[model samples]
Target chain A: MPKPNRSFDKSLWVFHVNTGSCNGCDIEILAALTPRYDVERFGIKLVGSPRHADALLVTGPVSRDMVDKLKRFYEQVPDPKEVIVVGSCGISGGVFHESYDLAGPVDRIIPVDVYVPGCPPRPEAIIDGVVKAWMKLERLRGENR
Target chain B: MADEIIHFVEIIIGVFLVAVFGMIFGLLTKGIDRKLAAHMQWRVGPPVIQPFLDVKKLFCKENVVPRNAVAWLYNVAPIVCLTSVIAILLYIPMGSIPPILKGYGDVILILYLLTIPSLAMVAGGFASGSPFATVGAQREMVLMMSYEFPLATTIIALGWKISTLYPGEAAFSLTTFTKYPVWNIMGPFGIIGAIILLVVMILVTTGEITKVPFDIAEAETEIAEGVFVEYSGRNLGLFYLADAVKTVVMASLIVALFFPYNLSTYLGSSIHLPSIAWNAIDFLFYLLKLEIVIFFSMTFIRVSVARFKVDQVVKVYWGYLTLAALIALVLIALDILL
Candidate 1:
C-alpha cells in the first residue's frame, strides 16, 4: 500500500466529459455533488478543462462525432493521470453500442484506470472507484517500493 | 366525520404549502450542487435559476407519449410520483408540530412512503412498453431488491435500538426517536453499533435515492433514459420535480433520524424563553442543522465519487455491507444482553 500521505494520489482533479449520453448519467453525476451525496468531503473535484485535470470522468458512449473531442481531452490531461469511465455506456457502449454513429466503450480510445458501472453508479461507489484509482496510480508509479 | 373532514382539510393545506417549499428547496439544492462542483473544478457553473428555467421550459414544450403506451399510466405516473414525494414531507417533523403523521407512525410509515416514487417510476416505465422503458423498469426492480434488504436491516436495527433505549414507548415513531436523539447513549459497543449503523444507513440511503453511481435504473446512456424513455413535456417535468422532492424528503428523514436538534434547548431552559422566542429559535436551529447536514454529510459524497456497476452494487450490499450490518446487530444484541 502507498503510504497514507502520498502527494500524487491525494489531490486528484477530475474532468467530466459526455460523448453521447441521454442525460440520465449526467444527472446522476450531478447528484454526486448534491447535498445527498457530496463527494468533496473526500477532496475529489470535477474539473472543467482536461488540461488541468488529474482524472477524467467519461460518461456516455463515445459517439463518432464526439470521439475527436474526447481524444483531445484525454491527450491534453498531463501524464500520471487516471481516467474513470462513470457509467455502463462509457465502459461497454451500453445500449448505444449498436448505434450506427458510435465509436464507444471509452477504453478503446483512452486508457481507463477504473470502471464504475451502474447505469450511473452511486456517489459513494464513485468515491470508492476514485480511491481505487488513486491506489492504482500509486501502484503504477511503483510507490510501494 | 365533521371533525375528521376539518383535520383532513388542514392537512391538505399544510401539505400543499410544504410541497411548494419542498420544490423551491429542491431546486436550490440542485443549484448549490452545481455551483459547488463548478467551484471545486475552478470554473463558473450556471446560475441557481438554471434548473428552474429548464423545468419551466419543459412545461411550455409539447407533451408527447409513445403511440403504443398505456396512456393513462404514462400520463398519471409523474403526478402520482410527485404527489407521493410531496406526501412524504408530511410525515417528517421539519420543526415543532410533533410530526404530521405522529399518531399514525413516523419512520415505519416514512420508510414505506419513501419507496412510492420509485414504484411509480417502475409502473410508469412498464406502461410505456418501449424497449428502453422495459429494461429500465427491470433494472429498477433489481436495484430496489438490491438496496431494500440492507436498508430494512439498518432501519430495524435502528428501530430496535431506539425502542430499547426508551422502554415502554408504544409508538415506533422516528420523530419520537429524533425528539430524544441516539448519539447521547452510553456503552462503547452501543456507540460503535450506532456509528456503524449510521454509516450503513448513509450508504443505503444514497443507494435508495438512486443518485450518482447507484443510478442504474434510469441511466440514460445505458438504457436510453431508462424508465423515463417515453415521457416528454409537462409529464417529464413532473417526474423531474418528483425526483427532486424525493431528494429533499430523504435528506430530511436522515436529519430526523440522526440529528434532530431543537434550538430552544440551547437557550438553557425551555420555559425561560418567551413562547414566541422559543418557537423562533427552535425553527431557526432546525433549518440550519438540516442545511449543514445536507452540505456536509450528503452532497459532499455526491461530488467525490463515481458510479458502480449493477452487479458490483448487488455484491457490495448483499455480500459485504449486509454482513457488516449483521455483525453490528450481533454486537449490539450482545451488549444489550450482557
Candidate 2:
C-alpha cells in the first residue's frame, strides 16, 4: 500500500463512543469542544457517524455487555483511521479493574494509538491526546513509504 | 443555421463557467458562514480554507457501499443532486450577466429545478436501505411539501403584479423582476405587502436550505446525520458541494427578486471609470450583498436557535408562514384595485 496521505491530518473528524463507563470522560470530551477550549481551531470535530470519522475517541472501560458493540463500532470506521482511548477506565478499567464483568483496558479489544489516562482527563489533556494521535499517524505514514 | 450553431456553442461555454463559479463562491460563502457563527459564540473558528481542505480529504478516502443499499441508485443520486443545482444557476442571472439559457426558462422553471436536488436526496436516502435514512427521507419529503406552497405563492404574487402593470410582456420571467423592481411599481399598501412577502420569502429560504431550527431532517443529535447516515468518502463530498451551491442559489434568488439594484447603475457615471471597471465593481458589491443575506438568514439564525421537531417544522411552514403570505397577497391585490 502507498503511504497514507497527510491531508486528513489537518481535519480530524472524531466519533465518540461510550463503552459502559461513568459519564465523566464523556463530559470532558464535550468540554473540549466548548468556546474556552475550542478544538475546532485545530480542525477537530465530533461527527455523529463513524463512517465519516478519521479517529475513534472511545471513553469508559469495556464491560461484558459492551464488548461486542465496541468491536462492531471499531469495524464500522473506515480504513486510514486511528483510535484514542480516553479516561483511565478505558486504559485499565480504572476502579472497575477488579470487577467480574470487566472486559477492558481498551487495547486488549482494539488497537489503540493513544491512551489518555485520568479519572476524567481534563479538556486540555484530551486535546493533547488528539495531538499524540496525529503524531502516530505521521509515524505510520513514514513507515508505509 | 450559422446563428443557431454559434448560439449552441455559447450556451455550452456559459454552462461550464457558471458551474465553476457556483462551486468556488458557494464554498467560500460556507467558510464565511462557519467563521461568523464561531465568532458569535466567542470562539476562534477553523481557517477559512477549512471547507476546501475537508473536500480534498474526503476525496482521498475510501468510498464504502453498505451491504443492503441499492448500489447503483445510491451512487447516482449525488451526481444528479449536484447537477440539478447547477442547472438552476443556468436559469437565474448572476450579477450583471444574463442567465445562460435566458429565454428558455423562467421563475416557474427555476422553482421546479430547485426541488430536484432535494428529491434526489430523498431517493438516495431511500436507496441506502437504512432505517435512519428512511425516516430522514420521509421528513425531507414532508418539509418540501410544506415549504413549496409559500415559495410558489411569493413568486406568483410578484408575477401577478407585473402582469397587471404591463399586460403583454413575459410576466414570470426573472428578468422582468430585475427590470421593474417590485418596490418601485407599487402603491403604499403594495410596499407593505411586499415587505411581508419579503419576510415570508426569507423564512421560506431558511427551510429551503435546511439550516438550524429548520433542519429536522438532518438533526445530527437525534438521527446521527440522518439522510447522510450511510454516505462516505466522495459521495459525502458531492453532497457537501451541492449544499454549498444551493446556499448561493437561494441567496441569489432572494437578491434577484427583492434587492436587484446594482451599485454600478447608481455610481458608474459619477466615478467616470470604464465600463469593465464598473462591471467588476458591481459584481463585488453583489457578493457583499450576498454575504450579508447569508449571514443574517443562515448563520445568525443557525447559531441562535435549536432544531425543531419534524412535526413543528411542518406546522410553522404550513400554518403561520402560509397565512402571512396570503395576507401579503391580499394587500398587494388591494393596492392594485384601490
Candidate 3:
C-alpha cells in the first residue's frame, strides 16, 4: 500500500473504539482531548464517525463479543489510515488475558501501528504514541519514495 | 446584442471572483470562530489555519461510498449545497458594495435560496440509506420549518415598514435597506422593535448555520455525525467548505439588514485619504463588523450552550422566537401610526 500524503500527516482525525475495556483506558483517551493535553493543537481531533477518521484509537483487550464489531469499525475508516492500540489490555489482554470471553490482544485481530502500554496510559503517553504513529508514517513514506 | 454580450462576460467574471472570495472568507471566519471559542473555554485552541489544513487532508483521503447509498445523488448533494450558498452571496451585499446580482433578486429571493442548502442536505441524507442519516434529515426538516417562521416574520416586518415609508418603492428589495437604514427610519417604539427583530435574526442565524445548540441534525455524540455519517474524503470536504461559506452568508445577511453602515461614509470627508484607500478602510471595517456579529451570534453562544434536543429547538424557534418576532412587527407598525 502507498504511504499517506503530507496533508494526512498534518491533520489526523481519530475515531476511538472500545472493545469491552474496563473503562480506564477509554477515560484516559478522553483525557487526551481535554485542555490539559489538548490533542487538537496537533490537529488530532476525536471524530464521531469512522468514515471521517484518519486513525482508529482502539482501546481494551478484544472481548469475544466485540471482535466482529471492532473489525467492522476498522473497515469503515477510509484508506491511508493507521490503527493505534492503547492500554496494556489491548496489547496482551492484561488482567483479562485468561478470561473466558477473551479474543484479544488487539494486534491479533488487526494490524496495529503503535502501542501505548499502561493499565491506562497517561494522556502524555497517549500523545507520545500519536507522535510515534506519525513517525511510522514518515518512515513508510520514505520507503515508498 | 454587443452590450448584452459584454454584460454577460462581466457577470461571469463577477461570479467567479465572488465564489473565490466567499470560500476564502468563509474558511477564515470559521477559523476565527474556533480560535475565539477555544480562548473562551480557557484553552489554547487549534491554529487559525486548521480548517484549511483539514480540507486539504480530507481531499487527500480515500473517498468511501457506502454500499447502500444512491451513489449519484450522494455525490451530487455537496456540490449543490456549496453552489446554493455561493449563489446566496451573489444576492446579498458585501461590505459597502452592492450584490453582484443586485437588480435581479431581493430579500425574498434570498429567503428561498437559504432553504435550498438545507433541503439538499436532507435529500443527500435520505439517499445515503442510513437510519442515522434519515433521523438527522428529519430533524433538519423540522428545524428548517421551525426557523423559517421567525425569519420570514422579521424580513416581512422590515420590508413592510420600508414600503410604508416609501410607497412607490420595491418593498422587498435589499437596495431599499441600504438607502433607508432601519435605524434611521424608526422612532423610539420602532427602534425597540427593530432591536427585538435583530435578536431574533441572530438567534435564527445560530439555527440557519446549524451550529451548537441548534445542531441537533449533526449531533456527533448522539447520532454519530448524523446526516454526514456516511460521507468521507472529497464529499465531506465540500460539505465543510459549504458550512464555512454559509457562515459568511449568514453573518453578511445580518450586516446587510441591520448594520450596513460603511466606514467610508462616516470617515470619507474627515480623512483626506484617496478613493482606493477609503474603499480599503471600509472593507476592513466591514470585516470587523463581521467578526463582531459572528462572535456574538455564533462563537459566544456556541461556547456557552450545549446542543438542544430536536423538540427543544422547535419550541425555542417556533414557540418563543416567533412570538418575539411578531411582537417586534407589531411595535414597528405602532411606531409608524403614532
DockQ of 3: 0.72
lDDT of 2 by residue, B112-229 (tens): 9999999999999999998989988988899999999999999998899999999887999988888888899989989999999888888888888889989877878988888888
Candidate number that wins on lDDT, 1 or 2: 2
User: For model 3 chain B, where is the 10-residue window of minimal lDDT?
Assistant: B93-102
Runs in model 1 lying further than 4 Å from the true structure = A1-145, B1-6, B268-273, B296-298
Error of 1 at A84 (Å): 30
Best by DockQ: 3
For the predicted complex of model 2, DockQ is 0.66
Chain A vs. true chain A, TM-score per candidate?
A: 0.88, 0.95, 0.95
Give the runs in model 2 whose Cα sits over 4 Å from its true position. Answer: A1-4
Sort all candidates by DockQ, best to worst.
3, 2, 1
Q: Name the candidate, 1 or 3, with the larger lDDT value.
A: 3
The TM-score measured for candidate 3 stands at 0.98
For candidate 1, what TM-score does chain B get against the true chain B?
0.92
DockQ of each: 0.02, 0.66, 0.72
Interface RMSD, prediction 1: 18.7
Q: Which candidate order results from sorting by TM-score in descending order? A: 3, 2, 1
Distance from true location, Cα of B195 in model 2, Å:
1.1
lDDT of 3 by residue, B1-338 (tens): 99999989988999999999989988889888988888888878888988898998888778988999999999999999999999999998766777889799999999999999999899889988899999999999999999999999999999999999999989898888877889999999999999999999999999999999999999999999999999999999999999999999999899889998887788777888888877777778878898999998999999999999888999999899999999999999999899
Candidate 3 on A1-145: residue-level lDDT in tens?
4357886666899999999889999999888888888888788899999999989999998899988999999999998889999999999999988999999699899999999999899999999999999998888788889
